[model samples]
Target: MEKSVSKKAEQTLKKARVKYPIGVKLVVIITVLLLVSLGTITFLVSAMVSSDVRITAEDNNFTVNRRSATEAENKLNTVRSNVFLLLDMLNAAGSSAALSRQASAFFFERNQDIAAVVIPGSLELVNTRFFVSNEIETTLITLFLQNEAAAVRRAVAGEPLLINAAPVFGVPVIAMLYPWQESGYEQAVVTFFSSEDLTESFGSGANSSFMVNDQGDVLVHADYNLVRAGANMANTPIVQAMQESGDRNLQLLYTDQEGNRFFSAFRKISIGDAAVITSIEYNIVFEGIAATTRRNIFLTAAVLFAAILFIWFFSKTISSPVRVLAAAAGQIEQGNFEINLKAKTQDELGLLTDSFVNMSRGLAERERLKDTFGRFINKDIAEKAMKGELTLGGETKHVTIFFSDIRSFTAISEKLEPHEIVGFLNDYMTRMVRCVNDTNGVVDKFIGDAVMAVWGAPISAGSPMADALNCVRSALMMRAALLEFNEGRGGEKKPIIKIGCGINTGDVVAGQIGSSERMEYTVIGDAVNLASRTEALNKPLGTDILITENTYNLIKDYLIVEEMPSVTVKGKEKPVRMFAVVNIPDANDIPGAGAKGPRTLAEVRNLLGIKAPDMNKVDTDAEEQKYKIQES
Candidate 1:
């Protein structure tokens, strides 16, 4: 027993040749596939999110810069308009004394951030309060004169010009002025406001605002030192980007002289030579991005951890049972039929485990009975009987019966030893049974060296014509099987094997027969008898296969057959016609050659010169009434 089990184990190992078990492989493969899928999705999502964040940040920078610049421009324009309105009001007053009174009133009423209004070419005080001394006005006039050429040129071109850090009472001020040609003189109303005014108008949280001249000179800036000192930042990437851009607006990333990177949006306002610039430190702008990235990383890590846990749990839940089943199957493979699996769940895997347990019991029982019943009946039929497909009852069904017998089997058996006879019979029966089963015919029984098979009973091939054709095919295959069997026995001094087959199609009773304790599934009635009688005629007709008129009619179009004599049998008064099946020709053999009645047969015979026997004389009435019983 131990040797037997060891040999079975060796056979299983040789068949599978696997290095590792299925559970580990399943877990590894599933984990790898899932990780690859999720990893790809995460990468793509991260890339898209990062791109959108950058785009949104840049767009927001543009919006903020443009808005702040517009606000600053509006403030400057209001101050210049007030100064111009005062000048016009003084001109309307028609006297220097009335102009002085109007200027005094306007200066007192206006914002304190506006220092004084002056005419550029003549250095005339267009508007001033009592607080503005002659010396302070004179100093402002001198600064305006120093930069008068550039400012006047811009003013003459119908543009507002702003001068950064003009001296007024030794204090830095932003000077914005407009020019008009009055009395052939280029006169202008210039407003001087502190840099504090510009800073207050454009200040923002997390960002800085500044104005730069065309020479990249820091004009109005929150840092008073840069404004007072007139710092030059001409080499800055932000200024260079603006100068290179044709749209007069630019958003860029720049690093300052201190090597601090920043994101900057700059717009050259139409009001002056100055461009309004808004800047946020790179750290400030990327703070949100960093926070989002950290959140995403944490989320991705959490998801990956959860996925790992799920994969572990899934592997345990699914592979544990599968591994158990595999181990149990290995035991069964080693010839140990005792297997009991506890399937607690109702899933497919649990059902598979339950099936394995039942199969082990079934295999054990089959092992105990295979030698006894399997020799009498086919293993397939014996198993079906055990499965309750065969029972002690019968039903009349349309069936095609097949019968095949070895030619001169008794003489051949007499020449061989008992063991040799068994071997020869096993080989012959195995091949012939394969042919019958392959063609969907059920082997009813074995009668010595003969086989009885039927189609269309119990499980029909769907139709009578199909069953009939299958019966003829099975008969032909059995003859071919015998020829092949003979070829394999080339070196032996044994007789070459030959088989004769016959088939008939009709209604027959098919089911279990004999005693209740030892029943056998079979077919009975006249159809089965006719099949046997036709098989016996094969020896006299010198043919391998013959079919009764009923089967011949069903398969005549597919097969090349010759008509034989119509013989009266003991069963009925009618003579039964039989045909010898030579071979199936082709798919397009004879058209409409098998459709009932005399017309098809007449056309077949007339076209193919098929010889039909004369249906001449009748035997005695007593001989017809002999009451010959057919086998059941």
Candidate 2:
């Protein structure tokens, strides 16, 4: 016995080994490692290439800065020439007595105007004028002091003057006189140029450019700092470098005291002898290059890091199937059936994957049994039966009962084969069952090609009228569907099928009512019998669907009907009034189609024109009571 047990254990081990070979395990490991290695190498190479590009961009930015500085200086020189020409006009007039007087009158003719004059040492106003009553008045000007020197002075004997000053109040004033008498007025005109205006014409090209005097004071910056105080380029690196080497063209990477780095280039502008240093920041030249490079580097690094991490994480997950399976089994044991395992290998890990397979098969088998039982019985009934609630004893409850049958099933069946007849019966029963279900009706069973359906028991149809109308509508819709069905099967040759639906809404006993060994669910009462009788009456009346007066009155609001004269229905002593349901009208019609018999109850009475004793004359409650009394 001990030897047999040992042999069995060895045999089981051998079978498992055969299913999951050693070679397959090696292959999985090698493949996973190779993928990880390739991913890591690719990430590192991309990062290195991006870093090199960043370095190249930094160098290019330095070169661009130098070129922009030179351009700014040239623009300033052009502006200087224009200003000088305006000043020369004043000087030429000062050289001639006639021209000078004409110049003074020109200023005096305008109100509050000062005659601008260029003398040997200064630019002055000879005659200041003022305005009064829309007339130029040289006498009314109280503040006309003439012969004032301008604020600007030439840096060298031959250098032109540069100045910008506005008049005070309405009095025009000019100062900053350059000595142009020795070189004629034409030479004096060349002295008046603006460095500030010159810098503005750079056309969105550079950030800013400024000139600094040798005294380390700001002579003129760009338009950005014209009104600002304490603006100068003297203390800037461009000036310091120029003073040190006297190199007009110089490049240096200078970081401001505020930590803003700049690639600066310096060039000296010489007017005769004095020099003005020009400086420009590199970012002003390159604009968005460095910032874009830095952004790209950061973005590339972030993407590479995320990619590597993802690859490593995915590789580790793929390598550990046993761990995943163990986790899944734990969840399944705890009743969490949503766990899924992805098989990545055909090795032992994949071969040992039968727990989920077995669990799924067991669950599927249980579900199939539950659904199959639910079809035979009501879903609630099947559930209750499964829980052992369906006992043999009967329980009675109030229900509305209905019964229906194909009007001529025997004649219809004779024309078709046995299989075809079965198909027809199934098709007819299915439509009837669907109708019953739609009205919250429960189908008890099929008695041959007939159906017994009930409402207001397992679930209530809300009102008796609604229950009756539901059965009527179902019969109408079934008849419509049967026409289509017959058309498909060669209508006339297939024996056109018709249905008779009878509905009676009243109180009845409904529950499981059969022997203990074989139980059945059904309703039993006088109302049930009346409903069956009404269905039989359909044949005699030549109607497809019929309902008792009690059923019609309950759902009179939702059914179109034609009345049949009072007729004696077997069990009842008094004659019963019946209606043949035609169609239910749409809500948008002139009159709702469901308005029984006609648009109004009067129309129904008029159309039937019956002279028999009115239904209201007989007490239905009394007749029902009499039937109960006789049954007891």
lDDT per residue for candidate 2 within 1-632, as digits (tens), equals 99999999999776556455646655675576556555555565555564455345445544444444455445444434433443455567666867756755654454222233334344443343223332444332223222113222342244444332212222211122343544533223222222333344332344344444454444444443432343445566656776776666665667777777665555555542123333345455444555555665666666557656766675564457767777877776775665566556555655556546557556656657778987887766676677787776554655557777876678777778898888777876776677667657778778898888777666666766666656666665555555555565545337656666777767777667788788876778888888887776565455666777887777777666778656565578877787877667642232223433245434432333322344344433444432211111
Q: lDDT of all the models against the reference?
A: 0.71, 0.55
**Per-prediction TM-score:** 0.48, 0.42
Q: Considering summed lDDT, which 10 consecutive residues are worst modelled in model 2? A: 166-175
Pairs that collide in candidate 1 are none
| Alpha carbon deviation, residue 208, candidate 2 (Å) | 3.8
5-72 per-residue lDDT for model 1 (tens digits): 99999996565443454556667867775676567557755665666766777788788788878877
In angstroms, what RMSD does candidate 1 have relative to the true structure? 15.8
Total backbone clashes of candidate 1, pairs 3 or more residues apart or in separate chains: 0
Question: Against the true structure, what is every candidate's RMSD?
Answer: 15.8, 14.8
